[model samples]
Target: MLLQVEPMIPALRRYARALLRDTSAADDLVQDCLERVITYWNSRRNNDDTRSWVFAILHNLAMTALRKYAGTQGMHVAIDDVAESQMVARATQEDALHYRDLMSALDALPAEQRSVLLLVSVEDMSYADVARVLDIPIGTVMSRLSRAREKLLRITAAGVPAAAPMSVLRRVK
Candidate 1:
């Protein structure tokens, strides 16, 4: 089982990083996820798809962390505050701008749509597997993915960040 899990580490890390948007926190989440996977290994159904099950575990952990932090002012640092040495040099200015734009568009998506998009496009998971991991119907997964793609296109085309929906915007108490 360990051997089977070894190849999945990079993918898991990428997924976690994208979900959390904080490197250290994402790493800790992945560690916690691995621990849970190890502790509950025997309890998983033998016929279950290991990849889907593992992703489901990671998703659940991420959701819990998100909920836990939902009420707090999240730690956010501006790019100018970071040291120049920490920034990776892109091959071209255009590449860096495009990358930034794409990431911004992704960040603007609702959590549900973003998760479905990342699982399907970034991680290359099937609709069925994404449904299992996200605990949504396959049709819901498809609709979310479609909406995500359309929103990304709109955001990128307009060269403006999409506004968060009213429900997604936290009210200041």
Candidate 2:
């Protein structure tokens, strides 16, 4: 089980980081998720997909944390302050700008839509899996994904920075 779960850590971290927008907090969340997975491993149905079950645990934990912190202000860190070594690769100037714009657009989306988008597009989860993870109907998953994509296209096409203000960050919770 540990060996099976080891390969999922990177994807879990990425999803957590995208959801929380804070590296340390995301790492903490992933840790908590893994702990819960280990504790409850035997309780899971034999036929259930482990990936979806793990993601569901993570999503539930993120939602709980977001709610817990909704009314409080936390320390804010600028992206430029992050160490260069932490980046996966050196991006060209154009790629960096494009990636920034894309992330900003993603951040502008409602949490529901963004969650659906990331799970489907970035994590490569099937709609059925995403629906299971999110406890939403498959049709709802498809609709939210469609809306997220359309919104992203419109934001990128406008060539305007869509990053929400820091004061509004908690609204995504």
Candidate 3:
């Protein structure tokens, strides 16, 4: 069981980091997830994929944390909290700007959409696996992923709709 879970650590960390946007918090969540998996290992169905099972554990823990945090201060990602090295290593100003924009867009996403997006795009999990991990239908996972992509595009587009001028409508008497 340890060997099976070891190979998935890096991917799990990446997904966790994307969700929490804080390295230490992400690590803590991962640790909690691993502990939960070990504690419940015997109860899990044998036919289930261990990888998906572990991921499901992690996702549940993240959701719980989000809820806890939301009750206190609302869930949010601190883009500025990211490591300085990561922010400074971009090859050019344009790349840095784009990266920041993408991160902002991701941070702006609702938790459900963000979770599905990261599981699919960052962890490279199949849609079916993501659905299992998130405990949603596969079609719902696809829909969330699609909406996430569209929102990101709109956020990064040349003209963000939110920033556009509002037109005044005059009513004829």
TM-score of each: 0.82, 0.82, 0.78
Q: Model 3 residue 9 lDDT?
A: 89
**lDDT for residue 43 in candidate 3, whole number 0-100:** 96
Query: Clash totals for all models, in order?
Result: 0, 0, 0
- lDDT per residue (tens digit) for residues 1-173 in model 2: 99878899999999999898888899999999999999999999999999999999999999998889889888777878778787656879999898888889998899999999999999999999999999999999999999999999999898887884435335543
lDDT of 3 at 156: 73
Q: What ordering of candidates by TM-score runs from best to worst?
A: 1, 2, 3
Residue 20 CA error for candidate 3 (Å)? 0.4
In model 3, what are the clashing residue pairs, if there are any?
none
What TM-score, to 2 decimals, does candidate 2 have?
0.82
Model 3 lDDT per residue over 128-155, tens place: 9998898899999999999999988877
- Candidate 1 lDDT, 1-173, residue by residue in tens: 89978788899999999998888789899999899899999999999999999999999999999989988886887888666867865468888677777888898899999999999999999999999999999999999999999999898888764553325567788
Off by over 4 Å in 1: 74-94, 163-173
- Compared with the true structure, the alpha-carbon lDDT of candidate 3 equals 0.84
Clashes of 1: 0
